[model samples]
Target: MAMFVHLTAAANTPRIRRAGIRADSRGQGGVRGVYCFPVLPSYTLTHQWLRELARFGPKGALSAVHVRLDDAQEVLVGHYRDRAKDAQQWLTAAEAVARVAAQPDPRGWEVVVPRAIGTREVHRIRAVPQVAGWRYLPGAHGTRPCTCFGCRIRGEYGGRRLRERHPHPLDGPPPPVPVLLARIEAAGDPGDPAALRDALHWFGLRRRGPVDRLARLAAHPDPTVRRELVWAVQGWSTPGVAELLDALAEDPHPDVREAVADVRTL
Candidate 1:
């Protein structure tokens, strides 16, 4: 037999003890299963998913259900992202344990049994420390975050604060033109490519702005900055924009000229 541990809300202990662990959908393609980690010699490895699972349960209180399955019982085992039917490999319960145990770091690996665990298969349920494992991803602590809109969930804990602090490039409202211009001006001599790109992005968003102050960026040494200028000036009703586009249309860089052609078509 192969030993595995299933983590769940502490509140579910009574029902689980009565009916055993019911199989649930793994959140994609109606494929139902019970997710577990093979009970390895290392306690931390056996319960590595506890902290991440706690986010979906009642606060951080969770119980570990120890289960015993026949070594030949077929199960799916792979990284969490490979849960799709075609991506995961079917391995026996014992093989799954060996695969995960051999890994130097298996934080995101999982085992999914296709059917409910019988009451006889469940050995015991015990409370575990709320802080037993990594969250977000293994070794994610101390890493800089990617605050793009697609990476953030609206109502998730601290999501609102994070979005406000680091607004998405394309989702949030653009800052006023004067603020962007000030940022460019504060960038000094050759100027910050990031600040210039930020200002240009706002032009793409607003599509219409005073171009007199921005006309100088067309001559910026960076072809990317000039290409962004081509994108920024498209569809603007402001004066001198036509002349600016005409100049960008003949830019030395083929990419900048291509951007100008693209803008003209739009």
Candidate 2:
């Protein structure tokens, strides 16, 4: 936590001052002046110092500060009435401020202090630190563990494990065809590449189900979806499936065409 700083409103109170030198419009714009604030003695503006202050400060007194450090001069501060839940959010703001200050760039940048910090956002900031010349691992430097899609997949399929399989009784309830089809349709519609990939794999195991609805998605905008769809349709003896593969052979994406070629050979 930060060292507690004694703050007072009295104008006569002595305060510590830091000097900042900057250039101006004049030919000799290099002017310098002391900036004074009622901070505790011996406190320096650093990440560790800021973190400590944020840790001890009352939620009511802290807020998420967003600064577009660029020339646009856009600055926003988020103040949720409930500070208890928002303390971490404000700490993120403090960290961003310290990071920007450390950068040597003359141009400004943009950042937001979210009211609720998600794991994805946490992973993003750590993987790509705001300050220049710094690098760290996932969940490094006290950040939470990264469970982003890429990381999760790496964990699931890395090393000797080719894939995850759960064998079921041959006569068990037909693998919820309607539910899987619905999920596949939903994933194909604005089609996130990863979700579609998982859905396609689901199809691989239950290849005997009716796929007329799923096959309609053959013309999906994303070629990745089309490629996986082609893979899922393999081994079906239906003429419709063959037609689908034949049409995909002419897909604009070379990879999709290549997938169709491979499936044809099989």
Candidate 3:
């Protein structure tokens, strides 16, 4: 048999002890399964997901449910990123353990058993240190933080401090409307597509700006710049934006037209 551990809320201990770990859909495309890590000789690695899991539930402790499974049992195993369909692979339970053990750093490795683990397969349920594992992603500490709106969750622990510390170039919060307008003007005659895109994105975030000045971009040669303009003009309370959007509705570029269609639906 191969040993593995599943980290879960301590409150679930009684139910898990009675009925075992139930399989649930938690991954992309609703892949239903119990997630676990191979039990290695390293104690820290054996319970590396504890701290990460703690961030989800009500304030409480976490526990490690040790399990035993047949060596020949079929399972899916891969790095965290491999959860994507094209990258995932199937292996025997024993093969999963061996693959993870062979890695120099197994921080993001995981295994998914397609079925529930019956109470008979559980070895023991024990409390683990609340701080046993890396938070966010492995080796994330002491490195530059990604302040993108997608990566930084608002109101999460230390989130405000992190954004204040490492502001992302393009994904960070928008400047005032005047600053964005100055940036657009500085892009000059031919216009820098990237800088214009950045400024237009900032305008989109503000959602209300000088639409008359921005309307001139409808004839920009670059389809991408026009597409950004479409996104920026959505929901603006300013005058002439409706006429501007109607003109863009006839753009020859499919992407720009598609963006205008999307804005209309919003």
Top of the candidates by lDDT: 3
Residue 134 in model 2: lDDT = 14
**lDDT tens digits, residue span 26-87, model 3:** 64345688999999999999888887777665468988899999999988888887755657
Q: What is the C-alpha RMSD of each candidate to the true structure, in Å?
A: 9.4, 18.8, 5.0
**In order, how many clashes per candidate?**
0, 6, 0
TM-score winner, 2 or 3: 3
Give the whole-model CA lDDT for all candidates, comma-separated.
Answer: 0.83, 0.41, 0.85
Of candidate 1, the 10-residue stretch with the lowest lDDT total is: 146-155
Q: How accurate is candidate 1 locally (lDDT)?
A: 0.83
lDDT for each residue of candidate 2 in 228-261, tens digit (9 for 90 to 100)? 8888777666557877778888889999999988
Candidate 3: give the clashing pairs: none
Model 2 spans with C-alpha error above 4 angstroms: 1-174
Clash pairs, candidate 2, are 1-52, 2-52, 2-53, 69-108, 70-108, 70-109
Off by over 4 Å in 3: 26-31, 54-61, 83-88, 177-197, 205-226, 229-257, 260-266
Clash count, predicted structure 2: 6
